[model samples]
Target: MMAEKEVQLPILRSVYQDLTRSEQRIADYITSHADEIMDKTIPELARNTKSAEITISRFCKKLGFSGLQGLKIALAAELSSSGDDRFQDIHRGDSYEQVAGKIFGNIAEGMQDTLKILDYAAVERAINALVQARRVAVYGFGNSATVCRDIETRFLRFGMVVQAYDDISQQLTSASLLTAEDVVIAVSHSGSTMNLLKTVEVAKKSGAKIIVITSYAQSNLAKIGDIVLTGMGREVHYRSESVASRLIHMAITDVLYTGIAMQQPEQYQENIGKMRSVISATRE
Candidate 1:
């Protein structure tokens, strides 16, 4: 397996069809006036797009940032690479302060939007699967590969033996040792990562139950897995939510982790209190 830092981030193809009409319009607008919109604050951007702030935040999350700051970083990143201001006019008429509310609005909406389609049953079922697994191999690549790593840590709290493999070879080797006794969870927004798909195929061939978490259940990666959980929507280049996709993914993780913890009520309560204590201490 290649070193973690050496792993390449997959270049995502435009999942444009996955977006709603308004989101598509926003995306088109961004693409058309990339130089102009990059300069606007969240509210200004919202005004230009004729979308609410909430919608804008959700739009940013879809592209994988946590909040507006992240979106700006992405824009800055875009600018750093292109050395051009693509957002000259998108928020041209607005003041920085007026744009802030819409920015918050976009973030608030992104949070709600992600939860709107979350699959509760699948989360429970995944918990049950994890609770029973002898071992698990989590997979994804590029931007999503780390989420698999994050999920691995979540499984560890329940005391399940887990491994997250991003390399094609390591994942294949891990699959060779599995049986129906194990579970494999794969995450990809596009569900088309070749490395991810290959390992999933290997695990399936080895009689393991495969679970796929992605944005599109209709994707090939979702089809191969025995169970699929979807958590994605339209792309509007909104940049309001900053990083809503990770928030949504984190929420899904939160639910799955809670469901697993709840399976043992006493442990769940104890763990919750302990967790709260730690968090409370951090508040100081």
Candidate 2:
């Protein structure tokens, strides 16, 4: 199936944090005057946003468009659509059903928005690296640690020599042992965790390949990564949790796990059979 096209306004909103100041100005202009943006030329848009023409072009490309024309087409389509199902807040005093609906809706939207920006080429590269590596180490911190643990659990069933590190000290120690034959999957949502970066740097010096899963592809973590997978989402009010970044990271890692399985179907089947046999014996 063909990939779904990203909606202009929602993409602009989702990736706002990663944009430069000039790009933010352009985004603000487009979002506020979306209906009128189609009528204006690129030069006119640059003038209106107090940015250069090239800046407008970069802004358009940053939003996954070819250029101004592509952005305009998406904007026009959004304008023509009947409803605005953009990000919404979960209000207080709502009934149980209302809250549940908003949470589920936001999670689904987060995944779809993430799909819009996912780099398929990078994903393939990551799978190849994992499949060939002599060892794999997954690292993350705080809320991200849960994702790391989940990856550890899933990849083990495939019989890959992988470990998850949530503690910075343990991560640094592990990094020191990685070799060029290994791969490191680092999860940092903001991509600005100093300790995580330090650990990754150590791994890089040891010559391990880096695969970064983060919200901002422009983040320092992404900069040094061999392959970068970005996840996008805006924070909702009330819970204010990053529904997008958290879930999307898990989703991408799951995709990697599945890809590795597909690459070694016979091995995967054998490993799964052995694992199931042991687990089944423990059941009543």
Candidate 3:
């Protein structure tokens, strides 16, 4: 059986435009010579790229690796594969079909990679918290707020008490009202949104358990989460938020929703039926 391939290089290229000049230099050098980089030490790489060792280490972390060694290992694994031509970025001069293919391909690959790194134990813990909580509050800002709303709608179908707050002040107020019996699901792609972080801080103080859905595990928000679920994706340039990341977040939400429904099939089925009946009555 063939080993699964890592998506490091493709992820690097996807976020290349967002990297600082020094980080870009290191990324370019490593990408262009994956095999060579695997053999070189961090100091060697920094010297070769004319960048500082600390800069190289930061670059590695930015790509979701723990450090230089982790980056090299992932690079070696990826290089050993047939290579990832599917994740190539969409270019300006591409035809409609080409653009569609690239976008679809990137999303597919991202979902696959996300599955590889998913911490099922953490997911189960999060589901348990949601199942037992008296109330659930979803907090997010910007594009992440949309994800929070989507989660709210899905959970509501199961007859769960859920609230989604997009406004900063409202989120703070809602979080402050949460108690030990409540749960907070905070979504942030960057995991460093100050407003969202502030709300989470308040929620934590109120003794509400926090479940974070974010891209980086090492982020401050993730540190505060009682249970952290990561949504990994290649962020493309020119977009304010990661399209692929949103899909992963939704996928995780679907898993939690389905798992909860399965825990009590009869009651969940009844809830769905009643919800559908109410909607149908409104239409008539």
lDDT of 2 at 62: 78
> In candidate 1, where is summed lDDT lowest over 10 consecutive residues?
4-13
Candidates' lDDT values, in order? Answer: 0.67, 0.84, 0.81
The total of clashing pairs for model 2 equals 0
Across 7-108, the per-residue lDDT of candidate 3 in tens digits comes to: 356556444556788988887777667667767888898899999889988988887789988987777766766355545676788898977777777777
Q: The CA-based lDDT of model 1 is what?
A: 0.67
**What is candidate 2's TM-score against the reference?**
0.89
* Candidate 3 Cα misplacement greater than 4 A, ranges: 1-33, 37-77, 80-84, 238-241
Clashes of 1: 29
For candidate 1, lDDT tens digit of each residue in 1-284? 43211110011113354667777666666665655655778898889889998988987777556766666655554444443212222164667774565554444544444554455677778888888888888887766777888888777766578878888889889988899999998878778778788888988999998888776645779779887776653233444221445555666777788787778878767766777798899999
Q: Estimate the TM-score of every prediction.
A: 0.59, 0.89, 0.78
Winner by TM-score between candidate 3 and candidate 1: 3
Check candidate 2 and list the clashing pairs. Answer: none
In model 1, what lDDT does residue 208 have? 93
RMSD of each: 14.7, 4.6, 5.0
- Candidate 1 ranges with C-alpha deviation above 4 Å: 1-104, 233-243, 268-284
